[model samples]
Target chain A: MKITCSKSNLVKGVSIVSKAVPSKTTMPILECILIDATTDIIKLTANDMELGIMTEISGDIIDRGMIAIDAKIFSEIVRKLPDNEVTIETLDNLQTVITCEKAKFDIAGKPGDEFAYLPIIEKEDSIEISQFTLKEVIRQTIFSISDSESNKLMTGELFDISDNILKVVSLDGHRISIRKVPLKKSVADRKLVVPGKTLIEISKILSGEAENVVSISYTKNHIVFEFDNTIVVSRLIEGEYFRIDQMLSSDYETKVRINKKELLSCIDRATLLVKEGDKKPIIINIGDELMELKIKSQIGSMNEEIMITKEGKDLLIGFNPKFLIDALRVIDDEEVTIYLMNAKAPCFIKDDAESYVYLILPVNFNSAA
Target chain B: MKITCSKSNLVKGVSIVSKAVPSKTTMPILECILIDATTDIIKLTANDMELGIMTEISGDIIDRGMIAIDAKIFSEIVRKLPDNEVTIETLDNLQTVITCEKAKFDIAGKPGDEFAYLPIIEKEDSIEISQFTLKEVIRQTIFSISDSESNKLMTGELFDISDNILKVVSLDGHRISIRKVPLKKSVADRKLVVPGKTLIEISKILSGEAENVVSISYTKNHIVFEFDNTIVVSRLIEGEYFRIDQMLSSDYETKVRINKKELLSCIDRATLLVKEGDKKPIIINIGDELMELKIKSQIGSMNEEIMITKEGKDLLIGFNPKFLIDALRVIDDEEVTIYLMNAKAPCFIKDDAESYVYLILPVNFNSAA
Candidate 1:
């Protein structure tokens, strides 16, 4: 491929597509980025079988041709090139020449015909959502996805959309997180399980701007996201997501409204007594206007009290400190209400607007001391 | 031990001594920080057998006693304590109680008698130098120290003091680096090898200010560094350091004077073509007012020309880009001069004052392409 582009524009295009390039692949072409200048606008594409990305380069197309070059070295060269126009040309032997000011690079390239093609998406049933809202929902729920390879279904998040509302739910065996957002308009009901890895990569690429809208289209086995100048296609996991709705409850015996920062810090301090590989849990005692956090390990014991506004009967529960920290860290609220049923039942942290819900199972300690 | 101190004061003292705490040791006492409150000033000490550090904490000593507590947990508790007066008391069962604000912790402690004591150093042989100069010298030469465990001496830097001048040298199998600084006054001449790991920890604790003076002393097997409110004692590496002085020569066939930044950036770009496990070396062609850097690998080839002022004959040579970058990154010069002998001899990068010298051996490539 022959093309002339500014350093900044070329670097941005390469980086966006390089994210999909497989670091170690048995097929050499999978490690390369296909550059196609056959059209009016230059295009760069990369596919790792499971995930694929394509981006358009805003530059002058000198000749209509296509070739694939190693993604890592090409991107590095473009990023370090002086802030000037860069010229890239390919020879008959598929050798690419990249030149910018006083610097020049001649690298070997392979024909683009062998590169895997990105799965096509029928756009008739596509939906649009603000990139900011989509990114926020993914961030809130992706952390709870199980990283274990044995259960493939738990490695993906469930995307359920109905009417104008989109709900994303993720659960490992220990906890479940759900986030809901309203779309700009109503759409037909659909459900898709997107791999957590794919959502993480997409979240990184999204601009997260309120004005930027992402058009999402899906088929039986593949899904596509179109935003900015890039298109990402990912394979959907073929399995049913956990029935998380049945596990959540609205009834509670005790409810407390406490400062998020205060509770988080108190639990964090109690965790100091916990050693690595220790299965100790932080215990919480909720009472009138007062909440106490306690942790006892073989090495030490720690406890701290935090003032809170409580309602209903007093309750005592124990939970993994990391689970509570993970939920509290993403919450953008001054104070949050936590609902508890009993020491053996799951506890819930939800908002009055019903935008986010987090349920964590309490740990059953042999002794409360 | 009973003491009352501000959270900040206690945290600082714990962090400084905690660096010497053994992360995993067969002897449990090695993982504890000895709290010696018997003196008027509260002191914290930790020793990992090879390295020991002690720091005086600003606190009101209520009772004269001593105890050893787990360093990791103690530091974590102190760091999370509220910014108020922290009261630490030891009970008869060797259980330590730490209380600050509304939080309290009861942790198990060991008798201080079992903890390793710091090696004492005679002050009559100590030499004082500005901490800023010492830190700068260590930064300039520490990168060249060999990290291989087979040659223990090469993993340390040689500190040679004579006549009011101190010279430090470090050498791996491939290169040698030397830095010189003038002491405040003349003292007894001595030479000792300090482990690179110890120097790294000391460098972190040193306050790099011109007004901060560091008192250094050494015995037959131990070296001490005293600055501010902290003192670090470390065992000196046995055996003689490499004789690097004989490897440095005042000879050159070509010399080039160029901007340090320009050369660094050029080499960095040339390195993009080199992949890990690739034995390719960046080649340099020195001629007149222009210098060219080239690198040819199995995947690609890159070359860039840098403007320079040359003296002596034109030459071609190859060297590892990493060694050059390491030296140039630490140099605080706008422009530096490089002296080259031949394609097989070592090259030197030095300033006009000769306070610092870095010698890097060139790689012999099969073809000078």
Candidate 2:
């Protein structure tokens, strides 16, 4: 393949596709990015069977052909090239030559036919949503996704859509996060379990552009997200997601409204006393005109009290301090409202507006300690 | 011990002492910092047997006593405390109570008598240098120090003072860096090897002050640096540092002056072709008017050429690109001068003004390739 393109543009395009290339793939071809040159554009594609990314850039094509080159080598070389026009061409014996100003790189290339075929999404089942909203939803829920490889379903975020509202849910059995955003147009109700890896890649490419729209297509086995000349496809987990709404407490004996910054700082201080393997639980004691958070471990014990607007009966609850910090980070409000059912039941935390809800399963502190 | 100090002041003092406390010390007492309260000041000390730090903070002392508390825990608690007056006192049964605003911490404390007694330096020989100048000298040479534990002497920087001039030198077998600064006052000529760990800690503490004076004292077995109200003592590694000056060639066959930024950028690009464990060597081909740098590894091959003002005949040299980058980072000049003795000999790189000098040993690329 022969093409001439701006160094900055090619670098960005190749980087996006390279993210899907596994560092150490059993199949050597999976480590290569397929490059194709047409009359007016150059296309790059990389896949690890589970996830695939394809991006196209406008360039001046001298000859139309295709070649597969090492994704890491190509990406690194392109990233270091000076910000100027760059020329790339395939030479005899399957060698790729990249030239920019006084710098040139000659890399061995493999046959493009050796690469696995990336799944193509049909346009008929595509639904468009604002990239800003999509990125926000992913950020709020992706952190709660389980990283354990044994449970494949929990490692993916569930995207549920009905009417004109889209809801994203993620849980790691210990903590659950749910975020909902209103869509601009009504679409058919659908649910897809997209892997956290794919959601993170999509969020990175979204770039917080409110006007940019992302078109998503999904089938029973695969899901595709298309945005700004780039398309990412991933194999969806074939399993039912946990019913997160049921895991949340239905009734709360106590509720408190506290400044988000003050509560976050207090939890951060309490975390110092929580040992890594010692349950890492912070007990919250709600009393008249006061709220106390305490963490006791072998190393030390810390107690912090903050004035909050509390109501109902006095209650005490213990949960992982990291869970509360994660939930507070995503809640967009000055004040956070925490709903406690009991010491053992799950606690629901959300902003006053209730656009996002986070639930944490309280640990049995007595038994764990 | 009972004392009330400003939160910021206590945080600063605790942070400096905590640097000497090892995270995983074999002796439990070594992991704690000793706090001694006097009538008008509170002293904090932490030691790892080899290195120790002592700093005092002016505070209101309600009582005079001493205690040892976990360094990590105390630092974290002090860091999170609000910017107000903080009261810390020793309770019964070897426990310390820290109170700041509405937060309270009951940290377990060890007996102060169990802590190791750090050796105090009483040498009359001392040198006064500006903190900024000393910090700059340390930065210019410390990166070249060998990190290997096999040769303890090479893991430290050699500080040689003579005739009102102080020189810092460090070498790892492959490269040597030397920085010299003229002191305002004349001090006795002495040479001491200060461990890289001590210099790093000193740099962290010297980051804010621009013109603060640092008083350094050296003995036969240890070196002490006192700045502000803090004193840091580190054990010296007894051995002879390699004669770096003897290894440098006096006459050069060719010399080149190039823009430091351009050369640094080119070396960074050339590093992309060098893989770990590949004996990362980049070949530089210098002509009368041009310079070409090339690297071929398992990943790929890259060639970059830059224009330069050269004198004498053509020459070629092979060296590690990272060493060159490290030296380039320390050079405070727009353009740098490179002196080449031959293809196989070490090359000396320095600025037009002789403030800092870097000598890089050439790699045998013929056998490596």
Residue runs of model 1 more than 4 Å from their true location after superposition: A367-369, B239-242, B367-369
lDDT of 2 by residue, B24-86 (tens): 878999989898774356889999987899999878889888889888788988998878899
lDDT of 1 at A25: 92
lDDT of 2: 0.86
Residues A1-369, model 2: lDDT tens digits = 788999888988898898799878789999998987743568899998989999998788888888999888888889888899999899878989999998889889999888887886654465778888899888888989999999998999988887777788999989889887877677889888999998887788776788998988888789988889998989988888887665665588888988999899889888888767667688888998789988888877888899999878898778888888888988778988888878878888876456788988887677534
DockQ of each model against the real complex?
Answer: 0.68, 0.76
- Give the Å shift of residue B100 in candidate 1: 2.5
Give the per-residue Cα lDDT of candidate 1 at A242. 78
Report candidate 1's fraction of native contacts: 0.86
For every candidate in turn, the CA RMSD to the true structure comes to: 2.2, 2.3
In terms of docking quality, model 2 is medium
Q: What is the C-alpha lDDT of each candidate?
A: 0.89, 0.86
